[model samples]
Target chain A: MNSPLITRFIFLFVFLSLINAQDKNGYFSLENRLKFGNFLFCKGDYIRAIDEYNFVLTKQNNDTLKFKIALAYQKLERYDESENSFKELFTSQQFGSEAKFEYFKTLYLSDKFETMHKRIADDSFIESSISDKLKRLYNLKHLYSSKSIEDSSKFFQPFNQNESIELLKFYVRKQNLDNKSPALAAVLSAIIPGLGKVYTENYGDGITAFLLTGVLTFLAIDNFNADHNFRGWLFTTLAAYFYAGNIYGSAASAVLFNANVRMNFDSDLTLFLNKNNHFSSNSNLFCK
Target chain B: MKKYIYILILFFCSVSFSNDELARQYEYADKLFNDQNYFEAITEFKRLSFFDEKNVYAYESNYKIGIAYKYGGFYDNSVFYLSHAIRTTENIDERIQAEFQIVRCNILRKTTDRALQLLSQMEKDSVYSNHQNEIHYWKGWSYMISDRWDSAAESFANISDDHELKILSEQVSNDKYSVTFARVISYILPGAGQFYTGNYLSGLMSLAWNVLWGYLTINSFIENRAFDGVAIGSLLWLRFYRGNIQNAEKLAVQKNIEIANTALLYLMENYRGEKP
Candidate 1:
């Protein structure tokens, strides 16, 4: 009985030693691979790093190892694969706040702007480490970049009264910033030709129209005096209508131009403040 | 010694369990493919393919994967996987299916010349005789895309006077109406062709507007309001007169489109016909 018990003890000792050796070997290999992967990632050898990380993932058992594998995939620009890995890490219990932040960054870098905006909107994604000012700035940038002007206005409206006003003005200015609405101005001018120039806010254009109409009237009168009655009558009628139309058009165009200018000025100021981190950061700081 | 034996047995059991699980997964994927859940089916098939690299069903699995992509509107992926299936499979039936599917994928991708070449090659082969009807149908569609109306009509006519295909042939043939006649009728009388095409309300509206403008200009001229006459005659009367002729031709063309679309929809939904 004593001999049997001693043999059992010896067997148990050998079994324990074998298990320890296997664990050590597995962990050492995983660590070495991870180190190499990090080096490759820093060198911008993303493809090789991805391969190494994938190898580690297949051989290692740790959840943390899995998260690093996903990060390496992101560095390789294998966005779809990286998103999958990060999503898995997010679902698992092994990741902490740092992992969560990196996961959000991965999502943002992937141009998944809409998803990132929603994530930031939810307070659960914001921890004590990330400043609220930075969060607001990110949200604003996403608001401007991902959404249409009309959509951005709606999104920015909830931030603050002054910010909303500023954004609205910027969008208005950006609308006609390129000055490509000449055809629209032309149509308005045709309705009263100098009127179009006034609509586009060219005051000199209104004066030019008045002078052209006057000269044509004078030519018609002079031609009629010289007995070119048909040509005179044609010029006179065209000159009469154009002169009246120009006056009407100029007034209408002036109002439209002023409105457009005011809208653009408001927008420009808001965009400038938003870009320089003046509005959102200061507002967030005050709120805190 | 007993403990060591138990440990070895445990490892063997785990490996066998994994193999069994993989087999089960493959079976599940096959069922999904049969059910036409191609997107999800491809995912499961890929997973099984990864785990069991030497699976005898790999050829069938890859073939089905391609078919699933084809049915799911992913033509490029379908072509890629179907080519893989063709290269890998020894099964004659699957090979024929893959070849036909590659042609079908090319057609959907708008690579008509490639599809035509494949169809032409298949037509010369005795083994592909059973696929003639499908090939003809695709050829007709190709002709339609290239706007070769006569050839499209001929292709559709070659199909057996089966009820569905006969209707499609009739639709293609009926679209050959004279646009010149439609334009002539509109020029002779504003909105007459629109009325002929069963658009009485639009025809009457066009006639009323044109007649009103024509009358106003003539009346202004009679009253010696020359300026008013000239302005209304050039801007309003001429615009409406031109618009009436153009509208008449447009109405005829629009009616033709409606007729063709109705027939096409019927063919797609109700016909128990062979598909391309």
Candidate 2:
């Protein structure tokens, strides 16, 4: 009787424990989950952080919490999702300007600069109410999207006198940096052997192109003069092909060189403006 | 007597309470994982591991995290945490499981050398002796992924005589053209290599081009038009001949890759074998 009773007691204990185990919320309360989610967010695991935030968001009406979800998305380079999240606070008045700015940032970071470029110039959107400093900064951003900083006037128009002069000087230095012209390169090579490559500063290739063409042309002429007509014509054809190829290659090199220049200038300008904060308050969102 | 009974009941209740919590958390994490919420499951599993002071769920949670990372395509992280899991557990089976997972990670990340190294090391060890066939199976997968069809077939041949992978790999190897042969033959005969490689149209075009240019040069020379003869011979004929050789070499390599990929794709989709 005693043996049977002890076994029954043990079964009852395990049964009660199993029941508690079946309950979903037996271990971690909702509050503890929120804490763990925040911990994950700080740990740079944005995807998991999103899960936690999404979990807590089910019963919450927190805008800041929502903004964090968007920020986390931005950090993860999921710009599309980030942009959508920022858009939710667009009508909140306090956060609208910041939201719009972040929205633009998402666009910029995603290399959709064309749309951001167009939107900045378009007047139908809410571009007026954002601060004057911010307006100028955005206008400058708009200008940088498509064209190189050819004329500093449009970009400097948004800054104070001192910063305007500083920006002007920066761009003036930028515009003076050596840049190649593909058209001019081709024209030069066409007019004179290897001249276009030399114009593009490819001295070694230019010299090689010159020597190869010169030797082949010389060989062709000598063969023709000596009545070795077949060899002469062969060298002539080769010389002509090389000359034309050199012209085409020089033009392509110049195009690549100019693109590199543009890329460098863009990065330099972005860094300079960011280092100086561009005289605007982009640190805090418009949500305030 | 009543006081002793109360103490016994109180002690049992606390022990069961904690046990219940562990079981609940593990099931919740499992549910999340089964639902395909990998990242969420990772967090839950990680939490369980962190709180399991008795080491009850520590090994399990860490392994789950590794699998989660693998499922998420974070192969490097998978390797990192799986290696950690390897050190945490003393279970021979789980350690081997983690080791295989690491091999999969390396292969998927295109580090075939690392995958092969690991597999070869495991082959030399007595620990994985029981799972030798399984080891060779994954080694074959690694070879198949890298398009080393011959080696893949060799790997599968050890598993069984008529293994499907072995047959598939054999077919891929046989179907592939030797790039060197194509190059050498093209060197000897203009466009002949392309013809041998089943590129009939290109071969015919190349042959016609070479023949036409050859005729032009020869006719010019016979007529004492030396200039025209040399011009046509070097400019058009030589260029076409060189281009034909280049195309033959390139086409042979491309065809081989295409054959390998076809077999790899079929096996990946239709095979009934144990897959990584």
List the DockQ of the predictions in order.
Answer: 0.02, 0.15
lDDT value, candidate 1, whole model: 0.66
lDDT of 2 by residue, A1-288 (tens): 378867766776666555544332423555656666666677677777787678778877667667778878987999889989988977756667677766766676576766776767766545666545445656556445544565566667667898777677556656576788899999999888799999988999899888878877986897799787876787798899999999999999898888887788778888887787655555434223
Off by over 4 Å in 1: A1-103, A106-288, B1-28, B37-40, B52-58, B89-93, B105-131, B141-152, B161-164, B175-180, B218-230
TM-score of 2: 0.74
**Model 1: iRMSD?**
10.8
> Model 2: runs farther than 4 Å from truth?
A1-28, A80-173, A203-248, A263-288, B1-9, B32-55, B68-74, B212-235
Residue B93's lDDT within candidate 1 is 81
- Count of backbone clashes, every candidate in sequence: 9, 8
Model 1 chain A weakest lDDT span, ten residues long: A279-288
- Clashing residue pairs for model 2: A94-A286, A94-A287, A95-A286, A95-A287, A229-B226, A229-B227, A230-B226, A230-B227
Clashing pairs in 1: A169-A267, A170-A267, A173-A264, A189-A193, A192-A245, A195-A249, A195-A250, A198-A253, A199-A253
Tens-digit per-residue lDDT, B137-210, candidate 1: 77776665444545666777777655345456556656645557767887888888777777899889888988
